[model samples]
Target: MQLPLFPLNLYLLPGGISKLRIFEPRYVRLVKLAMASDDGFGLCMEVNDNICHFGTRVIITDFDQMPDGFLGITIRAMDKFVINHQWQEEDGLRFAQTSVLPNWTPTEIKYIDRDLSQGLQMLFDEYPEHAAYYPQPDFEDMAWVCQRWLEILPLGTEQKQWFMSRNDHRAALSFLHSIIDEELKDK
Candidate 1:
């Protein structure tokens, strides 16, 4: 499970899609490789010198040259993974050995999760640009709901890594409650 790595604070969950601008020479090469191969690269969350073990394996779904002439690409997150080892090339492109994690089974969005549910709808309404990336959202799935929220919330990298490392997502759900509650208090 060797992969090319791109370390950014951005995270994408399984079934998530995001657009990225490729200008750095190293990343440009990495994007090309991901696009050309069936196996795509890993998107790691960079926290200081250490990258979070949890990451998403992404494949380029679309590509274009931006008006400014830099490469623009839209990637779809295929699945989650944990990095086992890593290294960098002379040009600074990061690569790693990863273990692909199991996809969560979908569950009906429960009543207790309505706030998490509404928050996403409010988000899409407020940020139409973010809404435009995902053509259809699987809001019925609790796993989908939690993962999407986890990606958007401004949680610390260590906290994010801690939540992501667990086999189940109960911790993430509770974390979301605190965040959603904080937002509710402000309004």
Candidate 2:
């Protein structure tokens, strides 16, 4: 499927709602297309300021046009996909042929131990302001949590891109644990 890409420095989790303030002309156009069509678009992470190969297909659940020529939109994640090919348009918008991937499996969840679970709970507890924003850490929730944490962590953009590109839920969770452990130790 060919979809319009919206590359950002943030991570979006499944079963999560991301409220975006779209001010750029191209993104505004993308929002309009989504509204007029199926209300779905791609939320992709950037690699060195470029869109990575993998991303999630999201639906615009709610949107309002701001008086300041921007759009406030809420997106719900629906599926994960890998960009098979990309084409750049004259207006700076990208069109990509994407291959949707299967859902994360149960075996991946087994890799998450009690220590990591408690650590995640503690991290959320420590950051009260970010608590509500944090999704429930579970097997079904790992993909989004991994993506979300990758975005919020003080890691390099390259690392964030790598995390987003990862498809194995277990590998992603393990990487997240290492990152969280390093963060906890530094504190």
Pick the lDDT winner.
1
Per-residue lDDT tens digits of candidate 2, residues 44-114? 87866678877888899878878887778978777778899987788777778999876554343345444
Instruction: Summarize candidate 1's per-residue lDDT along 2-28 as a digit string, tens digits.
Output: 999989888787888899999999999
Best by TM-score: 1
- Record all residue pairs in model 2 with backbone atoms less than 3 Å apart, i.e. clashing: none
Model 1 stretches with alpha carbons more than 4 Å out: 181-187
Q: Count steric clashes of candidate 2.
A: 0
Q: What is the lDDT for 140 in model 2? A: 37
Candidate 2: 10-residue stretch with minimal lDDT: 105-114
| TM-score of each candidate structure, all chains considered together | 0.91, 0.74
Clashes (candidate 1): 0
Which ten residues in a row are the worst by lDDT in model 1?
Answer: 161-170
